[model samples]
Target: MNTEKTSSQPAYEPGGCLTAVARGIALVVVVPVRLVWDALGYCLKHLWRWVLAPLARALGWLIEHLLLIPLRWLWEWLVVPVARALWWLVEHLLLIPLRWLWEWVLRPVARALWWVADLLVVTPIGWLWRHVFAPVGRVVGAALAWAWGIAGRISRAVGRALALVLWHAVGRPLAWAYRVVLTPVGHWLRTYVGRPVAEAARAVRAATREVWRALFGGPR
Candidate 1:
């Protein structure tokens, strides 16, 4: 009787091809965006509160007290005397323009609204006389389409003018409110959320620094 010898199985390489492929995919998908965000977060932690925030506050204060205040007084000082002198000179000039503008602006808007009302309400009623309410409704749709085109143009012009007025009237005041009145809210956010985050970041940075110091043999 002949006995056959059995061969031993070869050992598998741990984390061979599939592991490399998964690692490559992770590097490609995850690293760059994560690095960028982390860098920004790090900078915000180390830089923003410690550096730029004070500058922002200082600049805002400088703009408010140094620039805006002096300009306001100068404007009041110059405007009063000039207005008195040119009051009669430009009285007729301004009166005509003010009257014309006030008269014409509302007139155009009223005319547009009236035209729309006649087209929609009046013309639809006229169509109802000839046909049913369905046909009248169809005519109203077409009239509304025409009115929309005209209204769109007029509204764009009005919106631009109104935007400038709103910007000048409300923008600075809103900014001031946000800077001054909202300070407590900002401080609360910083105290509750931001301070903890910064503290965590400081811990992380310290740990990273220690790790780097160990590996590279230098202080971070």
Candidate 2:
């Protein structure tokens, strides 16, 4: 029997000339950029570590010792005691006197003025309005209302009488004349005079049309 040997490995080929050229171009372009980036990183790291960090520390120390310390001492020693003394003086001299004046003098004076105004002006006006003006106004209003009622009754009676007089004197006569005399006259005229005149006018118009038709030809 004949047997054949089989292999599971894949084939490999060497790179071409174009592949080498491309690799060389990429290397030439990337080397200088990579070097520049690394150098900048190194420089920045050392600058921060040595120069910038020390400068920041020195500035922080100077501010704490020179400015903040002196200000703190001034606030604790000088400003605090001065402020306390001024507050004490204001409380004793100005505020206490003003409070006492307002409580004792101004308040009592205002109360007395209010009482005087109430007694002199407000009380008298209230009494006059309640006692004198109110009663007088009520009496006058009642008298006017009574007069108005009487006048209204008289006017209504007069109006009714006038209506009755007009009905008897004018309205009844006119209605009677219209119903009796004018109605018969109008009916007679419409039947006899108006009907005859209209019929005569129609006859005359027909005769005139016949004459015209005879003289001329028939209507064009």
Please report the candidate that would top lDDT against the real structure: 2
What lDDT would each prediction earn against the true structure?
A: 0.88, 0.95
Give per-residue CA lDDT, model 2, range 1-220, as digits (tens): 1233234454454666679899999999999999999999999999999999999999999999999999999999999999999999999999999999999999999999999999999999999999999999999999999999999999999999999999999999999999999999999999999999999999999999999999986965
TM-score of 1: 0.28
Error of 2 at 153 (Å): 2.9
Q: Which residue segments of model 2 deviate by more than 4 Å?
A: 1-45, 65-101
Inter-residue clash pairs, candidate 1? none
Per-residue error (Å), model 2, residue 158: 2.4
Best by TM-score: 2
- Model 1 lDDT per residue over 6-115, tens place: 23544577778789999999999899999999999998887988889889999999999999989898888987778877986677789778878879987888899999
For model 1, give the RMSD to the true fold.
Answer: 57.9
